[model samples]
Target: MSGFVAGGPPPSGQTSPDGHINTSPFWPSIDLDALRGTLRLDNSISPPRLETAVIAAAISVNRELAAWRIEQQAAGYSKLEEVPGETVKGVPEQVHLYRRAIEAATGAEVCERYRSYDTTNSGGKKADDIAPNIDDYRRDLRWAIRDFLGTTRTTVELI
Candidate 1:
């Protein structure tokens, strides 16, 4: 895939191809296929373990994206400034797409877990929330994998 192209006129000191104003800087190329392949592998292995892995992976990727966006905003990118009465940044759209796919893939199991935890916590009781506990989430994820694969394996080493 192509690298990120910063939208707008080029930097002040740069010259354009026509020896006029620089149009824009060509950003480094991003290998979207590689990224998708990595993420897809995180999804495809051990169908039973899919829910936990997918959710955890989604959260991890989302956090990284958010941090990157923050860095870009700090660097005076179009993250804050409006362009023609409209927002210029596209991070939110990307995040929404990721979130929707993840939810669609694991919605049933996650919803059940969510309701269980939610109801338990509603009685003025302190129950551990499943969504925020990565270790427990991973353990449960492993269990799901084991169940789906029909094995009592405890460790899955992905190389």
Candidate 2:
């Protein structure tokens, strides 16, 4: 108990005993299998190369989703699920979404829908001047996170 830190994320690959932060990455995780099913690699690229990319992508996505899981935990929704394993079970629903996100990432880097900050161009158009077209996978994740937060975003007008 002395090593435990309160009000923060759980340790990697395991959840808190009280189910506080169950957002840790799955233990004994092998993203390669999932990646194999999702992707069709050419003979040119070796298995290890593909495996490394998938693992890295999964880890990245997992870390990012942890914040959302933590947020849900804070809001009293303790069921922010993840893939199940021996002696472990979490949000099964979210697993596919996360996997697809990883697959999409590995296939081709998802670019920002809109450009970053930039000045006006000679033709009067500018980068990031318009709305972005987020991919379905990303949009779904965003929606899920927003839903897990258990509140709809509302705008307020001040007069």
Candidate 3:
């Protein structure tokens, strides 16, 4: 994985000690074999596709947090290095949140199927076709990234 360049926080994301961050991979090089157990996925089936999705999701998650880092920096955070994943709001288990980011990006879903037509009753019951769902990640991703860096959430009293 030579060019497996995880975008180590975008430039706008934040500055680090000496204007450089710990360029080490935020998470270890994901071992698909190991993730199989944690993710409850069996490798005997389509491992390549699953692995690719997970890797892509991880990169996406990193990029998302990079933006949050930038915002945190602008909000007057100096010691940014001390902040990432420090068990703050919106992030309980950092690793678990990363897993969720993967699931969100890939739109991993489980649903029961139903076959029926629209129904309406004059005064008893009513049903209609549903509007399409837009794949918006802004809120959910930010919620996951809230504690990825310095000072994500704060309040000040003005007098």
lDDT leader? 2
Sort by TM-score, best first: 2, 3, 1
Stretches off by above 4 angstroms in model 3 are 1-24, 69-95, 103-143, 146-159
| CA error at residue 64 for candidate 1, angstroms | 3.5
The 10 consecutive residues of candidate 1 with the worst lDDT sum are 20-29
> Candidate 2, which segments miss by more than 4 Å at Cα?
1-28, 72-91, 109-159
**Per-residue lDDT of candidate 1, residues 95-124 (tens digit):** 333333333334334323333433543522
For each candidate in the order shown, give its overall lDDT on alpha carbons: 0.35, 0.43, 0.40
**Cα-lDDT of candidate 1:** 0.35
- Please tell me which predicted candidate would have the highest TM-score against the true structure: 2
| lDDT of candidate 3 over 85-113, digit per residue (tens) | 45645543555555545544433310000
If both were scored by TM-score, which would come out higher, candidate 1 or candidate 3?
A: 3
Q: What does the lDDT read for residue 94 in candidate 2?
A: 55
| Per-structure clash totals for the candidates | 0, 4, 2
